[model samples]
Target chain A: MIEAHQISVKIGAQFLLQGVSLKILPGEVVAVIGPNGAGKSTLLKVLSGEWVPSDGEVWMAGRPLRTWSILERARRRAVLPQDSTLAFPFTALEVVLMGRTPHCKDLERACDYEIARTALIAVGALHLEARLYPTLSGGERQRVQLARVLAQIGDTFSIHPCYLLLDEPIARLDLIHQYSTLQIVRDFARAGVGVLLILHDLNLVAQYADRIALLKSGRLIAEGSPWDVLTPEVIQSAFAMSVVVIPHPYLGCPLVIPSPGPDLVPNSVDLIGRCKEKK
Target chain B: MGTPAYVLTVKSLPRRRRSISVLTILVILLMAIVLASVGIGVVRISPGQIFAILVKQVGISLSRPFEEQQEVVLVAIRLPRGILGILVGAGLAVSGAAMQALFRNPLADPGLIGVSSGAALAAVSIIVLGTKLFGGLFHALGFFTLPVIAFIGGLGTTLAVYKLSHFEGRIQVTTTLLAGIAINTLAGAGIGLLTYMTTDVQLRSITFWNLGSLGGTTWTTVGVVAPFILAAIIFILQLSRPFNVLLLGEAEAEHLGVPVEPFKRRVVILVAMMVGAAVSMTGMIGFVGLIVPHLLRLMIGPDHRYLLPGSALLGPCLLLTADLIARTLIAPAELPLGIVTAFVGAPFFLWLLLQDRRRGKFL
Candidate 1:
């Protein structure tokens, strides 16, 4: 499990993240959803050991995060940033194989290559293996980067329960790729890897996320199962926009639809009044 | 989960046969260049006589006899010079490849660290003020004084750049480049001032040194430079994997288990040492490091595992070929080695840039 306990990040006088505590346990998918400037990426950075919090502490597997050597932490955790800017002529396979650096003793083994190929296959990027990374489309590059992070964890070769932290992994992906990528994360979680994702689309988050942590103004407004956190009152408070939450006919989850805008939607004022009363 | 099983389907990757073939070809080319370079000097020796003389040095008596003068010239004059060319070439080329990796910029070269300008500044200072500056000590050091002083200047400038760019715990790439720019300009001004102070004979030596040469190559100079260059090349060759990972940016490399800061620090120091040692001996040989690695990357791709070694081998070949032309094209009055390289390299590099632009793959 990866736990961020009362972590707050401060840059000068501003607090990017304030007293945000969260946990990603084994065999679970925790999605962090927020409006723009809600400090979702900063929280992810703190959790992934990229930034040290100004207050409180982070723990992974019952030990303080700082105690883990870089190698040991790398073996147990993998982070996929929002975007990776690799401007080299490396083939996709070569890019994927770089993830095996921490695992290999000296040179990468045949098994590591197999792991890399399997990762590409898992992310539906197998066909891109021979293509140069720089030549790939943006969506294709995202998938290849996803494959790289997956290859880094290599769950089949690791004995320890690992954590995967993704900051907007599906931002550039199409609808089909977005679902497929989330599904892949869901599968990894089901296979006992803890997955923490920062996502924008709430409807997809409603369907795939076991739990959702909603943030507003660098503060977590709500954290619970999708049903509890996706309520009209909670969504209205967090986004400052009226959203009608209704149960999906096909899926067993709440579906969120935003009421256009204050001037455009005639009923949005009424919905906001009702949400205020509930709040 | 207990070891999530994978049903392997993809075939294993092909072995590194291409890299092996490339290295093999380079080794063969280097051998031919070395032989041709050694045989083409003022006293021309046939390939057969050269082979006989070389074998005879190892206690083998060949049926073909060679002249004593030929053996004397070959062993004393040409052999050490050829070896020096190989060492300096390999050193500069490998250093270039490593610097490009560290900077993650294709245009980065050994000169970016202020080595060339600093060495030039030091060499010019010595030429203009050696006797006055050091009195009897400069004369006592004799042939060793200039190269040693130049090496210290190069190393000192590199360290200053490193110190200036290093902030808190991280090495800033932009700051390092800026620092290098600042140091190079300062060194250039120093060189200019010193050049102004020189007399007629002093000015001639300064000009010749600035143009670069292998004219004074001797066994002693080769022996002094051999260990530093060899150590640096071998060290860089072992870092191909780390270098490849580094191309993915610093944070990504760290996430992949590379200690990025220390790794970068080590590479910078070693490259400085490598380039410093070579520039001290040959003054300033250009283009080998910048062009060789870029050309090899185009042929074999940017896998440093192959690129580094390929550069190490091909660097010497180009340098030896250039040195041969430098001495021969102008006859008894030698053309400076640096001029020949620039005359060939500038056009070729521009053509490469045009090709990259046409392919829409400018680096």
Candidate 2:
């Protein structure tokens, strides 16, 4: 489990994250949802130990985050940044193999190669192993990155429950890929790994995330299950827009639909009829 | 997760095998070039005589006695100069590769970034002002003073450029390039001013230094610079793994258990040391660093594990070849080594750029 206790980050008199406390338990998916400049990425960085917290402390597996060596922390957690740009043309297999850096002394070991291949297979990108990374599409790149992170924490030598901290993993993916990616994360969570993701889509979060932490301007506004966090009042207050929260007809999860603004027409049927009458 | 329908294609395995073979070929080619370089000079030594001399020097008595003039030419003049060429070439190329990886750009070279010029300026200053400034102490220090001073200047300029380009924990590439340009210009101006103050003899030496030559290499100079280059190469080779990780970017590298700041510091220091040592000894040989690693990368991909060692081997080979051409192209009149390298390197670099542009891979 990963825990952040009253974490606050300040950069040149700007508060990037303020008094944010959260926990990611094994076998659970926690989604952080917020508006622009809500410090979602900053919070992920702090949690992943990429950025040190100015005020509070973070603990991973009962030890202070700072106490663990980088390699040890890396073995226990993997971070997926929003966008990872590569200047060199490395193959997909090579990119995945980079994740196994901290695990082995010799990079050329056959076991490491096997693990990397397994990771690529797991992400359904086995065919892309020989393909150059730059040639891959955006969605394919995202999957490849996912495979890399999976390989990072999937060391066969260690049996620790790893935590994955992802920043908008599905931000650029299409509909099917979005669901499949979340399903992959869910499968990892089900296998007792904690997954924390920063998400923009409310319905996706409602569908996959076991709990949602809603933030506005670097402060947590609400934290609970989707039903408890996705109320109309909470949505309106956090997002500065009115949204209707209803139950999904089949999945029994919350479905969020945005209500039109005061000046905008609400019904598409009425607009079409008005156009017909004018003709 | 579903099982992948496609079998795990031995994609990386073939590349690995090919890379190993390529490295072997490169090493063999470097050895051939070294032997060829040792044989061809103003006084041409036969390949058999060169071999006989080499074996005899190593305490192996050959059956046939070698001629005294051939022995002197091979052992005294050409050998030390050839070894120095190899050291300078390898050092510059390895440093160039490290700098390119550090900056995450292929175009970054020690010379382009003012490091070589910085060393040259310091060496020139010592040559021109050593007698006036330190008097007896400079003479007492003897041959060690130039390299020491040049190393300090090179390391100082590199650190300054690094500090200027780095803000917070991130290296800004544009800032680095701009800082490199500014430092290069400033160093060039300093060198020009030093040139203005020198006497006729000093001026001629300064011109030779600026053009870069291997004419003045001695065994003593070779012995002194070898250890620095060796240490730098070993240090850089060990860093190949971290350098590979760093290609993922600073933050990502840190997350992957790399101590990014310390790694960057070590890389910068080592690169400065290697480049400094080379520049102090050989004046300022350009483009060997810029060209070798790049060509190797295009051949063997960007895996630093292979790239670093590949550069080390190929660096010496290219330099030895260039030095051979410089010595032999005009027969009795030897061309400046740096001019030959630039003549070959500049057009190749332009070709690389044009190729990248045509492929729409412009940075």
Candidate 3:
């Protein structure tokens, strides 16, 4: 399990994350959802050990996250940042192989290569293995980066239950890839890896995430199973907008639909008048 | 579905094998160039005589008595200069490759980052203000004073740029570039100020040194700079894998367990040391660092494991060729080494930019 206990991150005078607490358990996917500027990415950064919180601490497995060496921490947790810009023309295979860096003593062993290949296959990016990264589309690059993070902590040699933290992994991906990528994450979760993803799509979170944490103004406004956390009041309070919470017809999870604001409601008389004028 | 054809093709022959073959070929080419460079200097020495002289230096008695003057010329003058050329070339090239990787921008070079200018400023200060600043200690340090001061200046400027560019543990590329520009301009202004204050003889020496030359190379100078260059090269080679990982971006590298901060610090220090030592000895030799690594990247891809070593080998070859031209182009009245390199390298760089533009990509 990975746990952030009352962690607060301050950048100068502004508090990016304040007294936020969350825990990710093995064999589950936790989705962090929030409006813009709600500190979702900052929370992920603090949890991933990329940023040191000003107060409180993070514990991974049995010890404080700071107590572990970078390599040891890496073996147990992997992070896929929101934007992984590759300026160089490295092939997809080479990019995937880089994930095996911490594990291998030398360049790479056959087993390491096998693990990377397996990751590429898992992400449905086997075709991209030979293509230059610069040539890949945004969605394709996202998948390749996902594969790299997977290969990092998902090595068959690792016996510990690992954690994968992805910040907006599906932001640039198309609908199809978004679903497929979440499905891949779900599979990893089922295999005993804890997966935490910061997502904008509440429906997808409802479909895949076992639990959801909603943040508003750097504070956790709600946290529970998706059905419990995706309540209309909670969504409205966190997002500062009205939403209709309904159960999905197929998956039976809570589906959030935003109500149109006053400005967006079209007046039938005005619309008809404009149409007549155009004619 | 079956496996993809591209995967199968890539799996058939590993890319590592291809990179290794390319590296081997480059090493061989470097050797050939070194031999050719050694033979074609001011007084032409045949390949056979060069070999005989090398063997004789190793304490092997020759069947025919080698001419004493020729032996002295070969061993004493040309050999040290040739070796120094190799060292400076290799050092600058590797530093260039490492800097490009560190900044995650191909335009990043040691010269662009103010390392060369900083060294030049320090050396120029020593030349112009040595008597006033150091008094009697200037002569006491002898030939060592300039390089020592230049090394400190180079290292200090690099650290400043690095610190200025780094924010909250992340390296901001634009800030780094901007800081480099700021430092370069400041160093250039310092050089200009020193130039204004110097005597006529000091001004001439400053002009000549700023233009750069390998004419000042001696065995003593080569011996002094060799360990730093060798150490930097080996250190960079060892860092090749981490540097490769770094290309994925800093956060990604960290996720893969690369201690990015420490790695970056070590790389900056080593590059400063190598470039400092090279510039202090040979003055400012531009473009070898910028061009060699880039050209090698084109040939072998951006795998730093191959790119770093490839740069090391090809950097020296390119430098030796440039030095040979610098010395021989005007004969007894030699052109500055920097002019020869920029003349060759600037055109090649522009061609590379045009090619990239034609391809609809801006590196």
Candidate 4:
């Protein structure tokens, strides 16, 4: 289990995360959802140990986060940032193979290559193996990066639990890719790897995540199963927008339909009419 | 899926084989250059005689007789000079590749990062004012004073540039390039000031050192430089995996289990040690680092496992070839090795920049 106890991350005069607490258990997919500037990404960074909380503790596998060596942590957890930058023209396969860095013995073992290729296949990026990473499209690059992180935490062979922390993993992906990506994450969780994802799409979160943690102004406003947290009132309080939560026609999960506020509705229509008048 | 797996395994095998062949070819080219460098100097020695001399030195007498004078020239002058050229060149190139990896920018070079200039400044200061300023320290260090001071200066500038361009754990690519320019300019001014303060003989040595020459190499100088460069190369070659991961960005490298900060610190120091030792012995030889690694990457791809060792092999071939041209171009009048490298390297760097611009990518 990965647990954050009363974590507060302060940068200069502002608090990015203030006294927020959360936990992720093995074999569960937890989605962190919030509007812009809600500290969703900050929370992910803190949990991944990329940034230390100004106040509070993060415990991973019953050990204090700071106490774990980077290699040990890397073997048990993998992080995928929102966007990756690689100026060098490394082939996509090479990039994915880097995920095997923590588990690499002396030279890269042949099985490591097998694991990396399996990861690329899992992300449906095996065809892009020979293409240079810099030449890949935004969505393709994200997939390759995802594959890299997956390759880092190998299969379920480990007796120790592993975790995957992702920040907006499906942002650049198209609808089909978004669904497939979420499905992969869900399957990974089903295989007993804990997954913590920061997602903006509430409906996808509803369908895929076992639970949702809604954040607003660095505080966890709601935390429960999707059915419990995806209520109109909770979402309205977090996003400050009117939303109607209806059952998915097929999937039976919450389908949130956001309605624009009263003032903006007429203003948008007026702007369209004004543009016609100008024409 | 099964077929694809088999094909993928088959596809990777040739690349590994090709990399090994590339290294093999570089090794052969290096040997040819070593022989050409040692034999083709002012008093030409034939390859066979050179071979016999080497055999004799190792206590294996060859059937062919060679003159003692020929042996003297081969063993005393050309041999040490050849060894120095290879060491300095390989050191500069490997460090250049390492720097590029460290900065995660293709254009990063020892010369661009102010390491060479910083070493030049320290060496110049020692030459012009060492006896007067720190006479006691100079006497104690004796032969090592210049290289040691130069190493400190190189290490100091590297740390400064590294620290300045880093924000939190991220490297600011533009800021790093800009800081390098600033330090290079400052070091240049310091070298210039020291140049003004020099006596006539000191002035000549400083000019020669600044321009870079291997004409002064002896067994003692080779002894001084070899340990540092060899140690640095050995250490850096082992870091191929970490350096490859580092190209993904610092945060990504850390996520992959590299202790990014400490790894970066160690790399900076090793690069400094390399540039410092090389500069101390042979002055500022530019572009061997930049050109060799960049060219090799174009051929072998940017896998540092191949790239680092490839640079080590190719760097010597380039520097030794350049040294040959420098010494033989004017025949004893001698051009500076730095000038030879810059003549080729500067235009190559400009072309690289233009290429990047054409592709619309700067960082």
Best by TM-score: 4
Q: Indicate the docking level reached by candidate 4.
A: medium
- Full-model lDDT for every candidate: 0.84, 0.87, 0.86, 0.90
Rank by TM-score, highest first: 4, 2, 3, 1
Q: What is the lDDT of candidate 2?
A: 0.87
- Residue A84 CA error for candidate 2 (Å)? 0.8
Candidates 3 and 4: which is better by lDDT? 4
Residues A60-165 of candidate 3: C-alpha lDDT, one tens digit per residue: 9879999988888778888999998887989998898898898887577776777778788878898889899989999899999999998888664247789999
RMSD of each: 5.7, 4.3, 3.8, 2.6
Q: Give the candidate number with the greatest DockQ.
A: 4
Across B40-61, the per-residue lDDT of candidate 2 in tens digits comes to 8767777778888889988987
What TM-score does prediction 3 earn? 0.93
Instruction: Tell the DockQ for candidate 3.
Output: 0.52
User: Native-contact fraction for each model?
Assistant: 0.47, 0.59, 0.65, 0.71
lDDT of 3: 0.86
Clash pairs detected, candidate 3: none
Interface RMSD of each: 2.4, 2.1, 3.2, 2.5
- Show where candidate 3 strays beyond 4 Å: A156-158, A261-279, B1-14, B64-66, B135-143, B168-170, B352-363
Candidate 1's DockQ is 0.40
